[model samples]
Target: MHNISKNNEKPEYGWFVKDLIVAFSIIGFIGIIFVSLGIFLTDLLQLFFIFAGIFIIVLFLWPGLGMAVMNIILDWKDDDITDSFDEMKRLEIPIILDIGCGTGRTAMKIVKALENGGHLYGIDIYNKMAISGNDLERVRKNAQLEGVAEKTTFQYGTATEIPFEDESFDIVNVSSVLHEIHDREDQKKAIKEIYRVLKPSGTVYIGEWNSRSAQLIGYMGIFCFVFKPSKYWEYLLKESNLTLMNVEEKGGFVLFTAQK
Candidate 1:
């Protein structure tokens, strides 16, 4: 492995830190007001204010805490990728495409999994707010650090308009990326693009969060609104003319395996 000094390693803040900070700040402001009111009100009113404040804090804090536990402590993303890869049929010298491969996290993992002389192409919009250090240079550097530089290629690209020729790749992996495309029409366009670039009978793995799942409700609370139900993705795949082969749901996260 390519070794780097400890100080050179930058932390990745995936997608939700800003939202979490804003939410907690707003809740803290409201909590202060509630506490002030309790200081001046009658005993019964003060008790009600205290309980209300606690309830509000707990409710809002739950999502952030849950996310931290899942992403940090449990390493949910890594586990999810591993599980998905285990289910995939092995390919010899496969040409793989990884969409929205921020900082080479998923791309590096996939490249490393290839024992044959396979190559993985990773593309992303590199939105700064989506992932800390989410830039082409950062991903390139990560691929080098992970010792997969020769096996991987990183570039600036979008899902709707993938910068590649038709039938160029043998397999495609898209993890937690579709929801970032806010417009439903654009999401459909992206799926079509994936279909256009895939070789005949090529496989595609799409991972997404199910907004309606109870686990998602507990983890994301109101933030679950950011995701779509599993049915939405199934519809998109079918409409794009991809054959949906399997749907795996684990802890509110769904992985759809389809074929071109």
Candidate 2:
């Protein structure tokens, strides 16, 4: 574990994993080339289908490629990748946990969203294979930059083994973090841990790639598809100790909410 601090360079709160984005982008580019070749080689009707396939492939692999247009048409009513805490605001929750909080991107946002005072705890493993900008020092600096350092605390922890006591938080969030665990049983174990740490009636929220769209038909979907994510999470949430509240999918990602 390490302490967070401000630095000379600007702090980056990136949402996309840089390595995955690059790998998928290169594959998407190659796919486009092949599809373009087939466009000219096939009938006009076939050409239309080829173009459609290419478009979806690009959107799936390239993060935020044409997201501006998507933003204009789709109403993502929730704040940037957050809805659980937004709900908590209505209840004036005092203690919150952002499990797998990478670089305080969502953690800082959670702090700002609080009109009522709430202390936010963020935990993550800040090692070499951690997400793009996942560093304890960086998260600390980011919290400082966002002016929420006092409202938030950064710590070292893993999803399968959270460092908090039972029923420790009123609200808990685990976003785009579980699928990173390759083992299916371990993923379920992590969800169980989420349930273990929530107070009775406390809310637990999770967001992840569901691979339900055209992304599933392309190379970019390979990573998330391997996990059978939607099915496992659905089964676990319904069968676990929590009451499933709401579930929705958008922009190739899914959000799930439950109450303990």
Instruction: For candidate 2, give the lDDT of residue 171.
Output: 90
Best by TM-score: 1
Alpha-carbon error at 98 in model 1, in Å? Answer: 0.7
* Most lDDT-accurate candidate: 1
lDDT (tens digit, per residue) of candidate 1 on 1-260? 33454667643425434455456557756765786788788879999887777666556655656654555643444553645764333778889999999877667767877777789999999877666557888888777766678888888899999999999998999988999999999999999999999999899999999999998887666778889999999988888799999899987889999998
Candidate 1 TM-score, C-alpha based: 0.84
Clashing pairs in 1: none
Clashing pairs in 2: none
Model 1, residue 114: C-alpha shift (Å)? 0.8
Q: Please list the Cα RMSD from the true structure of every candidate, rounded to 1 decimal place.
A: 3.3, 6.4
- Displacement of residue 143 (Cα, Å) in model 1 is 1.0
